[model samples]
Target: MQVFTQDDVLRFIYNEVDAKEKKSIEDALRLNPSLLTLYTELKEVVAKLGNAKMEPDNSTIDLIMAHSAASKMETSH
Candidate 1:
């Protein structure tokens, strides 16, 4: 039985863990109250992010492109 740390729980919640580790984390989640609470909060955040509709406006994109072009020119020089 592996005792997962907070980082491990976070990785599991974010789908960053491997299948084997995910199974381990899932088993721990079932019996750990604190991990369950943390998972719930992180899951809610992920859900909210998934529902988010964010798009940069044309002006913002232009500014970013201009900055990128300038940086490239500076590096090339």
Candidate 2:
């Protein structure tokens, strides 16, 4: 009867747990409503994060390129 923590649930969500721990968590999830709710919420968050897009804007990219070109010119001289 191991009490799973939020960290344990997170590892389970990411498939970082071993087979035995995975089975235990699955069993707990079936019998414990609270754990199941946590799992569901965390899983949704993980899914949303997976779908999230993050990239530098065009201005940031242009700034980086400009800096790189300036550095290259300084070195070549």
Best by lDDT: 2
Tens digits of per-residue lDDT for model 1, 16-65: 99999999899999999998898898889888899778888999999999
Error of 2 at 38 (Å): 0.5
Q: Compared with the true structure, what per-residue lDDT tens digits does model 2 show for residues 1-77? A: 88999899999999999999999999999998999999999999889998778898999999999999999999999
Candidate 1 worst ten-residue window by lDDT: 1-10
* C-alpha root-mean-square deviation, each candidate: 3.9, 3.3
TM-score result, candidate 2: 0.65
User: For model 2, what is the error of residue 59's alpha carbon versus the real structure, in angstroms, after optimal superposition?
Assistant: 16
**For each candidate, what TM-score against the reference?**
0.64, 0.65
Alpha-carbon local distance difference test for all models: 0.89, 0.95
lDDT of 1: 0.89
Candidate 2 stretches with Cα past 4 Å from truth are: 53-77
Measured by TM-score, the strongest candidate is 2
